[model samples]
Target: MRAYRYLDFITALFVVVLIVSNIASTKVVLLGPFTFDGGTILFPLAYIFGDVLTEVYGYKRSRRVIWTGFFLLILATLTFGIVNALPTPPDQQSTAQAFSAILGLVPRIVLASLVAYWVGEFVNSYVLAKLKIATQGRWLWTRTLGSTLIAQGLDTGLFLLIAFYGVWDNALLWTVFVSNYVFKVGVEALFTPLTYAVVGFLKRAEREDYYDRDTNFNPFAVR
Candidate 1:
């Protein structure tokens, strides 16, 4: 963990925020004529952080943070559900409605997000870490873009299917899927220069570019 200074700690927090935000918004928001989901912007950034974590800090620790995010999201949802179901005073009708609107998560949608996120993030991290070793740490762009394509594909496909399969028409459903996939990977691609800049700065600033040469790829057990 000390190999990359405080990256693991920050990553744990980032992943938690990513999961919660992903659950909060699954609909597209219009930026003028351009359309994109609120989650799309931030979600891809999680991948960027995941890449930075795994690429320069090794895969094992990254896995621990990923698992931490998963557990925290689960714990949050359970706690929220419990609180929402508790008895409320009749005089607090307004407060109850507000609480339900904000804390409410359809069980199916929450399940979908969890399934997609767990798979997608791990895929992104594992692929980036492996590519770093296989390429001898060359072509940083290739791994970043390639892994997102695959990871976000799993993410978008599963999330859309599980969250909106029969709820929307085929056209809109496919549109959402394509829109999200394009936006997410597009964000990563567009941010390539920034990714490089951040990576370089962290490597030098932290004086570490860890290689997971002998890492255990287990998605459990913190290091």
Candidate 2:
């Protein structure tokens, strides 16, 4: 298969955002009246990148990037788990404890994130690919926003419920869910213009605006 200049860069960015967002999610942040995890700030960028990837590269390549991200996340979580389990030197015990405090909670968060991300991203890409064909590639905003609305909804709801349903209060759990969904979708809407610019540039530069009309949509198929 031929390689594109920007696909690797975008894939790397996607993975970095995914990892950083998962780590940041360890802290619950409050801004004025709204309360949410720290990840909420940066996580939406991953979805935006997801939209761009599907929009430019088509769903098959996007699937590869998504699975790459999935495995990388698992590797990161395992590495953290190992480091957290190691013995600390006497003087560094406090520092180790701090590290543990931050990353110790990552297992569950990572679990929720991985599951939600896998399902959500594929759905986003698949929907956008179909929308691209259905709309005959017009109305870019509809594909981006439409896919994000459904994808982020699944992501927010599944992540919150799986990670904190029993741990947090029922009302607070739902509150976080609602807030996350709103904020993520809002981010996508806010970035629509930027998305349009990026997608346009990529299509022009690569000379390819892929439509998965005859392509297989199976999430498990790598090719």
Candidate 3:
């Protein structure tokens, strides 16, 4: 499959944002009545692109983008850990404090996040692409929402379990699990019409609508 030069650029920028957003996500802020993580805004955008990549381009291209994001996350996590380990200068105490607050994440938590992201995103792309074919390119809402529901469910449950399973009580873990799952999918569900609009616009603008009738579907092959 030939790459649209513009799409490749977007994918690169998207991966960078994914890394920075993961670090930024360590901080939380109140979004009116509810608390929201910084990553929430951009993370959903990534998934939307994940849907676009698979739906419009095919899973192979989406797989390449997913691997790019996965590696970038690993690199970002390692960079933060390394920088946090170094001793701080006497005058740089405040800088160190800020860095610790913003970028510092435990290795285990980072591992959990990486693992969850890799599996969740690929599954999302795969399911969406497959459904797109099975449905004969009909019911865009059903495929996008249905795949996100399942994919986000596994993502939330796995990440919470890996990152906070024993740290939080079972009830709290389950509470967070259910709440996060609902929130993520709710975010996608609320944006369903937007997804439809974007998909329609992209397909028309790009003049591409891939069915993946002959895709390799191998998770390991980057090509």
lDDT of 2 by residue, 49-90 (tens): 998998888888998999999999889889989999989889
- Candidate 2 local Cα displacement, residue 200, angstroms: 0.6
Enumerate clash totals for all models, in the order shown.
0, 0, 0
How would you encode candidate 3's per-residue C-alpha lDDT over 77-151 as one tens digit per residue?
888899999999999999999888878898767977888888889889989998998899999988888889888
Q: Please provide, for model 1 over 102-197, each residue's C-alpha lDDT reduced to its tens digit, 9 standing for 90 to 100.
A: 777788878888999899999998889888988999999998998899999998898888988998788888877888888889889999999899
Best-fitting candidate, scored by lDDT: 2
Off by over 4 Å in 1: 1-4, 26-28, 32-37, 221-223
Residue 121, candidate 2: C-alpha displacement in angstroms: 0.7
Residue 161 lDDT (model 3): 79
TM-score of each: 0.89, 0.97, 0.90
By TM-score, rank the candidates, best first.
2, 3, 1
* Comparing 1 and 2 on TM-score, the stronger one: 2
lDDT on C-alpha atoms for all candidate structures: 0.81, 0.89, 0.79
Best of the two (2, 3) by TM-score: 2
